[model samples]
Target: MIAWRAGAAYPPAGPFVPVAGGRLATLQAGPERNARGTVVLIHGASANAADPMEGVGRLLAARGFRVIAFDRPGHGWSDRLGAATPAAQADRIAEALGSLDPGPVIVLGHSWGGAAALALALDHPERVSGLVLVAPVALPFPQRVALPWYWRLAAQPPVAWLLSRTLGPPLALYYLRGASAQAFRPQPPSEGYLERARVPLAVRPGALLSNVEDLIGLPAALERQSPRYGSLSVPVLIVSGDADPLVRIEAQAEPLAKRIPGARLLRLPGLGHMVPWVAGDRLAEAVADFLPEAASTR
Candidate 1:
């Protein structure tokens, strides 16, 4: 009941599709057939498919591109499959893509989802014709950052299960508004973002456990994955805000672009971490410009 209340606080925006590992929930817009191309959206930690669906997915759909956003494994209405690593998440998402779409699709990932996007490109290159990574956490922290005490405690399996049923949802709800507000630092969050994004789904016991595990396990995954960026052959477009305090541009996007041969980097002067939400118009324009090239390659 607690898991139901916390994760299902808001109903899923779309349907579920069976895939390897488990099922995935997805929100799609645009024509199912005869569209210019398909765009697959992978959201980050503490977010569901609605985060990008409400931001850029619908906009791209209206522009005649098929836009589909997935609730990453263990997030929103999707099942948790012990998918803490990007490669594992990438495999699950790739399986769904293979079953659903007939051709390669443009994959766009935001924040933590960026790592999964890169993983997909590296492991399942045939599934991705191009990549759009926004404020992505592509590299390990330059310094050994200490984990929060609560996070460390919660990392214990039994403790996480206990907290999830008891205090996790309530505590997560208490800070939801503030965290949402902080994501758009320097720029206010879009109107009705909290309602539209369905962020409360992150509070569920299973989702919380998956999210914590993802965070704790990400550095090691990046260490193993970052070395392969130079080998990527797909068209890569990385968009980041110069003022993003959460994922510094210097550490992630800038260097990532340097590593990938022929990758394009767009640095928005005054933007923050929530680029897709606040800069949808600009983002759409960039995607529109790049689509022809991305499509041509497929």
Candidate 2:
């Protein structure tokens, strides 16, 4: 296998936190004591922590809040701990947070990262003071969406191993622009986001396999976990674009806002899945509403 270093593209914006799986890579900003609560950012499939949250992280940092972003297991500079379920990843992150000692935090999760953030709150409510979910897939759809035929093929060990080593990187590279455009329909991404975010890191042999397994396992995991959302004690803010081409607003954000007793939902008009890039500081401004001190200032 090829060894992938962290700083080549994305840069090491924070220290690596040692964990059971591997040294978890993180990007952090702000030590502004006058700021609001600490913020933890978790990114989704095919992305490292800095991918979706970079702009927002900077904005929050400028506002004086400590912002921390982690490259989840098996992606970016982080090593593959195992094939982890959301809850399992949550446990590992909890330990990582213990090492940081940032105190109770505001957690922001995008897409698949949203599930793990929810799991963190479910398993350890005292650790999360508030939550922000952007274009999340937090609820179990009444019916399972169909997976591609290739997903079935990859489910098998022999086929998966062959594909990961042979065709994965090429395929991911070939489809990069098209997929990003589709996901961001109605709004374009910032120029060169793919290169800036180091999209190639995700398509590396082992990362590809882990992402596939995570996608395949999501339905079952949400089936087991969706019921626990209402039991979470933290205040929540769920944001989605009405035009998001990836996760359905009705299927995820709307229903989740209703399900979680007091969770606030914001449906952005004419926006798409890449809201962090497309909307930028506006999203950060809305996120500030979740923190008590930030909200008071707002």
Candidate 3:
């Protein structure tokens, strides 16, 4: 195991470590000594790492795993904004893992972050001991063409630009609310949660452009790499909500599970895409079950 002393300047609660290629802004809480293993939590598009995984991190830490949550590039404090392709993001995570002492480390990702984690596992399998995918958007599902003709027309170039520039923030907020509503039935998000999320939505200047680029580039990336899932040697646990509107279970989770050898799948009957937020403790418990004996025992 590799041990690097924490710098005095680093936060006792959340430490910021500089990786060789890029910095990984991480928040960790757990036993100072005899930590079982590290669990790196990755978040989704338009949202930073802290927003989605913080609660889950706290829960996991309580269960004895050293949980580290970091902001993905272009989304949070590590704002080296440009094209944040899945492959590039994965490479950065690989570098961050290098800084830590070798142990059984689990990579847990939500939504787009799940795709990023998958990329990491594909590119650097040795760095990950296991994977927990929460409502992962794994494959490119069929696009909905039933919307109004004008909506489709607006999705094209300059018109889309005009609409995006004019109402992007509001539209983003609307979509966020819509996602929350569709994913979490019976109990909608509180005003405070949405309001707090608005801060990140409002402050992120490059979010719209980055999201568009991510959508444009992701399909090709998945097409290129989908066939290689069978080659992954690491243990994988896939969790998804049947009610998730954004990611189709058939197109994403089921197919990917079939391709990957020994991959376990857990489908929540009425749960939505926000599984990590809505069912975090339950998800963590499920993940804890899959962890290797060396890591889980500690």
Per-residue alpha-carbon lDDT of candidate 3 for residues 1-298, written as tens digits (9 for 90 to 100): 0001111221223566676545766666666567667788888766665555454777788888788776776555554435367777788777777876545478898888888888888898777888888877666543343234555555566766665566665566557667656545534654455443332342233445555556555666776767787888888899988877767677688887888888889998877677776777888898778777325323
Off by over 4 Å in 2: 1-13, 32-34, 142-144, 293-298
TM accuracy, model 1: 0.96
| lDDT leaderboard ranking | 1, 2, 3
Q: Candidate 2 on 1-298: residue-level lDDT in tens?
A: 3224323545555689998857788888887466677889988988887786564788888887888898888777777788467887887788899998887888888889999999998997767888899999887763335467778778687887788888876787678788777767887767878776676677777778878877878888899999988887678888899988789898789989988967889889988888777887888888776688323322
Q: Candidate 1's residue-wise lDDT over 127-180, tens digit each?
A: 999999999998877324636777878878899888877988888888989999
Query: Could you tell me how far off, in angstroms, the CA of residue 62 lies in candidate 1 after the best superposition?
Result: 0.8
Using Cα atoms with residue i matched to residue i, what is each candidate's TM-score against the true structure? Answer: 0.96, 0.92, 0.79
Query: Can you tell me which runs of candidate 3 are displaced by over 4 Å?
Result: 1-13, 20-22, 81-83, 142-167, 170-179, 182-187, 190-192, 195-203, 293-298
Better of 1 and 2 by TM-score: 1
Error of 1 at 172 (Å): 0.5
Q: What is the C-alpha lDDT of each candidate?
A: 0.88, 0.80, 0.67
On lDDT, the leading prediction is 1
State the local distance difference test value for candidate 1. Answer: 0.88
Model 1 clash pairs are none
By lDDT, the better pick of 1 and 2 is 1
